[model samples]
Target: MSRRTPYFFLLPAIVFLAWFMVVPALQIFYYSFLNYSVFSASTFVGMENYRRLFADVNFWWTLLNSFLFILVTPVLMFLSLVLALCVRNLQRGTKLFRTFYFLPVITPIVIAGIIWRWIFAEDTGIANYFLSLLSIPNVHWLTEYPTTIISIMLVTIWRGAGYYMMIFLAGLALIPKEVEEASLIDGATIFQQTFHILIPLLKPTLIFIFVISSTAAIKIFTEIYIMIPGAPMANKALVSFLYQQAFERFDLGYGSAVGVVLFLITLSFSYVNIKLIEQRG
Candidate 1:
């Protein structure tokens, strides 16, 4: 085989990455330093956009909201691992259960959001109807402050858990049966086996899921956009804030600044997670 064969095979992927990922990232970075709005002429005002972004109180709030939203990651990870473990040992109907759980993952986020929005509707929604049966007042799921954020988090968990479950299932499959049998022979409880053997072995998979889910939580926009259409202050996520600034308000430079900050945050989180996992290992 020619030494150049590997490069030939990699060329397509390299070109795709350069075009789709690298180029767009560079453009966003460049735009973050300028006063580029959709309606006006572009002018380079180095650091001004960043300065403005730092000074904006709402931007800081959005950042806080983004971090708060990431609280869903733990819930997602826990549920996914549990479900994966449950289905991993199933002797029958395993495929059916997996398909049922994963249906929400393949469902369009827009459609999911719409369905959830109606389900949680303030007046006539199913949630309130159930509450009414219990003599409780109609709880505002989306319009309320923390509840609005919580609603989105719940939707995120519902959509993401099964997807991550598949990752855990694959990791579980890679775990040697001999080790499990040895643990069983040693009279280890399921909990003990999971904690001592399964979890330790699944570290890499856990870290990957953590990073991916954290990033997804931070960059959450579509669900918020569709579920809470007008983006009330109580429910606004960082990406939703950026969308309003860039598309709705036409402040592209500021929006790009937000994007850069979001990128840095996600990168930092992923790095820290991987480092922590490595240190633990």
Candidate 2:
């Protein structure tokens, strides 16, 4: 085949990327430097929007919340790996278990958010009812600061764990059966084999999950938007803050500045993950 064949095949994808992702991202970056709003004429402000963004107390708080939200990454990685291991050795009905686990992934985020919102409601909610049965005091899951954050994190984990579990399952499937058999013959315990052999081999998948889950955690908006429509002080995420600025308040330039900052933060995280993987390799 001619060398041009590969380029020909990639042309459509390249064009799509340039037209959609690259153009839109460039526009956002340009807007970040302006004093643009829906109601006002655009004017070049040369980083004034970014300066104001950095100085704003609410912006700082939302950024802090975004970082705090990333705490869910470890929990998600651990639980997904554990679930993958449990299902990995199953001899029968594995498909059924996988389907059930992935049900949450396929469920629409809006629906999940609404359902969780009601579940965590202070009054006439199933969560409080269960707690009442256990003789525990009613706790406001979504009305308070840390509790609201935790509740959103729980919903995120529930929705994301199955997807990561599938990735882990694929990684596990790639392990050589001969290596496992040799370890078994050496009288290595299941724990020893998993910790020493399986986990080390699964490093790439772990890194991927870490990067993806961390990015998703940072960009979380729809869940918070749906769960707390007005985004009360306790539940405001960075993206929701951006949404409020751009759409609600018509501060388009400021919102784009927030978007740029978020992009940089997520890019840094992904870069760090890639570096760690490279060093491990």
Off by over 4 Å in 2: 1-11
lDDT agreement of model 2 with the native: 0.90
* Residues 1-281, model 1: lDDT tens digits: 99999999999999999999999989999999889888889999999999998998889887888889989999999999999999988899999999999999999999999999999999879989999999999888988777888999999999998999999999899999999999989999989999999998999888889888989899988888888886564358899889889998999999999999998998898788878777976
Candidate 2 residue pairs in backbone clash: none
Where is model 1 poorest over a 10-residue stretch in terms of lDDT?
A: 228-237
lDDT of 2 by residue, 181-230 (tens): 99999999999999999999898888888898989999988888888775
**TM per prediction:** 0.92, 0.94
Worst 10 residues of 2 by lDDT: 228-237
The true-versus-predicted C-alpha distance at residue 180 of model 2, in Å, is 1.0
Best by lDDT: 1
Candidate 1 regions with alpha-carbon error over 4 angstroms: 1-12, 273-281
Look at candidate 1 and tell me the lDDT of residue 101: 94
